[model samples]
Target: MNPAAPVHAIVLAGGRATRMGGVDKPAVVVGGRRMLDTALDAVNDCARIVVVGPRRSDLDSTVLQTQETPPGAGPVAGVAAGLAVLDAEPGDRVILLASDLPFAEPTMVEALAAAVQDADTVFAVDESGRLQFLLSAWRIGALTDRVRSLGSTVNQPMKALVPETFDTVLFRGVTDCDTPEDVERARGRAAASPVSIAEARRAILEVVPPLPPRSATLGTSLGATLAERLLAAEALPRIAVSAMDGYAVAGNGPWVLRDDIRYAGSSDELELADGEAARIATGAHLPSGATAVVRDEFAVVTNTSDGPQLSRSQDAPVRDDARRRGEDWHEGYRLAVEGTAVTPALVSAAASAEVTTAGVRGPVRAHVAVTGDEIRREGPLRRGQTRDALGPVLPQFLSWCGVRTVADTHLRDTSDSFDELFREVRQPDLIVIVGATGGGAADQLRAALDRAKARIVVGRVQCRPGGSQVTALLPDGRVVLGLPGNPYAAVATLLITVPSIVAALTGRTPAPRQLARIANASEVSGDATRILPAVPQPDGTWRVDPGIRTAHLAGIIDREALALVPAGAADGDLAELVPLPR
Candidate 1:
């Protein structure tokens, strides 16, 4: 095989699985992933992947997609259609695959490539001695010739394109699902279980579509993710400038010093001929004929017969302290890629690159509503009234997570309080409702969501102290993030879950996981995944307060993070750490 040649993939996914009742077979979920995703994973190393089927909304927008000449004609016709849109050299390789192969491995393609060196095509032989024609690799040139030789590709059996003398390699994981029983058997390989915290987060990320992006000045887009690549509008330091407070010298120093002093922001035109030097301040535009900048410390100035002259110190090391044009970035150079968070540093970098406005999703504007008739945030608290501890500090916690809290209000416990909040002229992208998530007489967030025709992405999480949390999408595109009423539970759930919602709303890349070995994981672990207050040790491990109360945030006062200790965790197992605001 030519190593320099590129390999392209054609995933045949348009087949009408009549035996499976015409369901989208490629989209069938088994082992917590779509079968089409499995197929795509197998071809991840290819130069490009072309899926021959109807455009799938869930598929990555970058993937090339097309359909057979007549939809669902056959795999042979699907191959011809895929080749129509495929961009590849005749010498490059092509890996044709069926989307229903849940167990297919990329190694199968490698093995086929090795065997196809001696033949035009190589097929994989399943354990049952049946050849999987679709799970094969082909020489692009030979495959195209065979395809062109055929009179008509429509309704043709895949076997018709097979060469008389093709090679075969026996490999496991070549299983294909043709019936419901087959899919069941594939799913049966993995144990059935309730969704874990990790699973819940993944579901929210996959299900929540990103909000539309809008152009905003970088000053107003802090914490928002870049919807498009941030390219430099113009070069950084658009002109050559001095990097130090010194003289802009031409040729070797010991030159005649000019009277003009170029200060920063001095746009007055200046120039220096050979054997000349001009006093220049740091960041000042260099004179027309300047070669380098000699710092004050590196140069000695002497009054000459005609004028002052500049010369380098005998002990000074050689250095050119001149910042050239485009030193930081050139015009049109990409400063940040799509999905990058607009951090403070990013904002400054964009400004340096002369990018003033960018298309961004959000720094996620959220309105926080504390629900309960008895809750009070005032000078005095009456009998049966509790001080609102969560409402005031929720914004600080949200700010730490990059969400901007726009409004904070108390929601009355009446039936229409939440209904009215939903129907009001909504401006914030998210409504964080603290309380009313559980099933109770006063808990009406769920009912209000139903009345508003909202889609509940997460009805309840499976973690302790925060199991009643909910995440829903309103019809008008606002997200309703319901939190538990207890201060600590609400905080813990907010810290762990809000990041995902923010990313879903703003298209921000989810922050990388922060994991630390839990020194006392076994002590805090419970029947379900436990979100416990944890303190860090000097040894870089974490310890949890297993007996801490979740009713108030006092237990976490001294803790630096919340350790997500899985059920049945051992003493030193690694646990994900959700950092507390310092």
Candidate 2:
């Protein structure tokens, strides 16, 4: 790799922010420059700047429209278009970033580029240890084939490409701005700063702390505190019943005759005298004196003047169906241990072993709040209104992890209203508010949260389309998350942020979402993680494309998964897509 090779920076600026009244988000201003410029300035050290979007004019850099091959579908096509323009040098590195991020810093970009020196790809890790796929570095040669595979829609997440041939770069510079209000807040911060870009960079870096390592354990009961070893089972006496009709006999004991026995039902008890025999059905307890009970089917009943005689039938030998006392369970056996998931089979086995109520960890609780005035209700929409779309979607997303909404409230997009709502719903272990955390006139979520004496855990993340995300902790010890109202941004914040908090609270390890790769190749600029909505194909692959219009519910209706285009994706670049959990 050449230490001085010219590096190209690609900024993705083509998101449609419908919540801000269907405005072009990149054109929104923060401080003195547009959000696009803020992102470009942060990565100025790169050799060239390429803007990837629908309109070339939206970006100040050399604009590249999505590729003509896949036509105008969505970000995956746009990325393929961008990567098609890059020079195919072996060591050339491309840094991809999202334009909506107002707080991204140049230092973070440099760090990501440096991390992917020998690997095919590298991405940023946020303060909470979540991977920022949009802000990353890519090795051009490694992703060339994958980029060509994307179709009109992207079904997989961008991170899926990493497992194919990539690595990761963790930094704090990839913040995204998804809603109109987020754009305004970035502008406000810029206006308040002597050097707005520097201030934003500082804000992003302040939240950078490595996440705690995840542990691998077995024998831990499902939901129980994890441990390396298995738990020991208690001593108990148990028996197994014959599943079929057959004779019971001790391996070394004499078999009793059929006629000398008194018939007993399946559950009947009997007392036997020495040298006496009894006929027992399946599940019937063996008499005290009888070593084994032979089946009547195999024993011959001979009628004579004396009492009927009994003996083994000449047809065949009776197979043993008898269970010895304490055969199923020994004095002691370890049936289950710690760190093991409590499966149905395990539960049943424990019951048979006389064990009940295995220790389990408790579930984590989450509270979500959606704030905004323009949000529509689910019922019929009047002349100029619609239903509150986000209200329904956000809860569905959280339900994937089995986390229920313990408390929720909707407030008007006003400071006082927001403050009041926060006061009411902050009782949950964790709280999430959707919309108005940005900078617009109606963006009162951040201010209202401030008034509630909430400590900003992570005020802003460095990523595209979802940068306005704010995480705070109330004085009463409840965690809160503020998500932008743009449907896509809100979904992204929940996907990236909420899951971690839920995992921490519930003591259950978060499982990885299923992953696939975009069939087409695309390129993007800058150093921010980019998330795109996509649909899955019959072949188990995903296609990257645009989402449904904000007003057209049909556009999002068939959305199969979320695709991630890393910061490293170049024009004609291949990225990973993670499917939403079913």
Candidate 3:
């Protein structure tokens, strides 16, 4: 804790882990990061980091690794092995850690190190007042003396090294993983926490991998992402040809016209003399000796003693109208790079370049389902029935996000309805379920996901109206996007979320966010990020529509985009814009 003294870390990562079924406990991932990495991160500012464990190839090469004496020996022996490799002084502080604590942070270590004022060592006490002997800070002299006194460090218990009357600092987040249930509890707690929009997107990207690439013809590859760079197979203009219906003259001006007429798609090759001119049509290949093509409007024809002579008009611009070979692109030239979308323009360009097939990921096919017994899609509505406004238009919204909806249907609010729907469908890459994201009586999607053994990536978000959204990945590699039953909230969440899902599934590069200054952001900003419709004013700034209803999309009829106003934003603040599909 001294300002001038150095601090080193000794992490005990070698363990039998009988309670964890002999698995590598330090390598176990919690909260998207490895537990061993958490311990190393807590001591990242230390002078040296020594990990006492079996050598792991995934560890950084700079980190020092050593095995305890006689290998399977206990924590005391691990401490001795770590101290042997450190070149620390007697007064230097040593942070002792067990690599199973996922929530142990550097602040906790600093507090423990600072609390060692009147004692030889300082350790943490958990919420239950149980001392965490391994999560401690010790003076190198004291630790060395204790290890030397113990003599044989093999199979020693932690109690043998614990100094009597050591100082203790209470910590709340130093929970350690000792069993499978503890690991699961940590994972559940991490998943249940609400994340910001950026955090949610980052988490989705970290967990979801792109689908495997496959070769598909350009005709069938529309909406797919290019897996490799698209190169020109051949030149745009295979050979020199006429750009207009003009004369293919052999040399400059006042030339005698030839008798033969050159038409398009004709392969007849004829050489032109120095003073000869031939009538050439558009797209027709030029003769071997032709230098340029003069359009009919730009040429003057006159009868000569032998034949008709062609001359350039004095008022016409002096220009060559012949299309040159390799004008657009030559062979081996890169047309599109990897991760580019296969839009109509790209397809046409590839076709023009004579590229027939390409390696690509998906266009992300999705299956849409609108859940709720009270929602009716057609026919006369009963007293409690509400019309399904989102079911019909969900595909259009998804299309704007680059997802093609394969099928859409209505699901009743029965307990087994979601389970049956998931079991029946298997082709689509995504399943979009509207409603049933909350904990209401009719909301059975979460329970069905549990039965399906899906991995929940984003349980909830820290946003208004759309905070109840959920994104999960099934074991079969399909994604499930759960939206609120409210139509406006569904559209708002879809606009902001589906793009990330598409990128995750198809390996498409995420587009940069569109930012615009909102003139009245303070009026619409709330404790959580507020997503609302907005209209563009005559000026460059946007005007927010703060008081729109979420039950339907009527409020967005005249809106240009949805403004993502940040929490606690002031007037004239910049907000991200999600443009509505026209």
> By TM-score, who's the top model here?
3
6, model 2: CA deviation in Å?
24
lDDT comparison, 1 vs 2, better candidate: 1
- Candidate numbers, best TM-score first, in rank order: 3, 1, 2
TM-score of model number 3: 0.79
What pairs collide in candidate 3?
A: none
Our tally of clashes for model 1 stands at: 0
Candidates 1 and 3, the one with greater TM-score: 3
User: How well does candidate 2 match the true structure, expressed as C-alpha RMSD?
Assistant: 18.1
lDDT accuracy of residue 137 in candidate 3 = 89
lDDT of 2 by residue, 1-582 (tens): 565555676777664455677677776655435677778887888876667665554444444444323432345444555677665465787887877777778887888777777666777777677777677777666555556554333434465455455566555434566775565565445533433222333332232221222342223333233222223354333444432344444333243334333333444555555544445566655655555556657656556565544556776565555676566556456664543444456656666665555444333356776776666666666776646777766666776644566665666766587666666664456667777878998888667666886556556665666678776656775666778777767776677666555554444444554556555425333476566667766766566663334332344456766666666555444454545655
Task: Determine which window of 10 residues in candidate 1 has minimal summed lDDT.
Answer: 187-196
lDDT of 3 by residue, 300-359 (tens): 999978889999998999899998999888998899999999999999999889998999
Model 1 per-residue lDDT tens digits across residues 469-492: 887778878888999999999999
Local lDDT at 37 for model 3: 88
Q: Rank the candidates by lDDT, best first.
A: 3, 1, 2
C-alpha RMSD of each candidate structure in angstroms: 10.6, 18.1, 5.4
For candidate 3, the clash count comes to 0
Q: Which candidate, 1 or 3, would have the higher lDDT against the true structure? A: 3
Which predicted model would earn the best lDDT?
Answer: 3
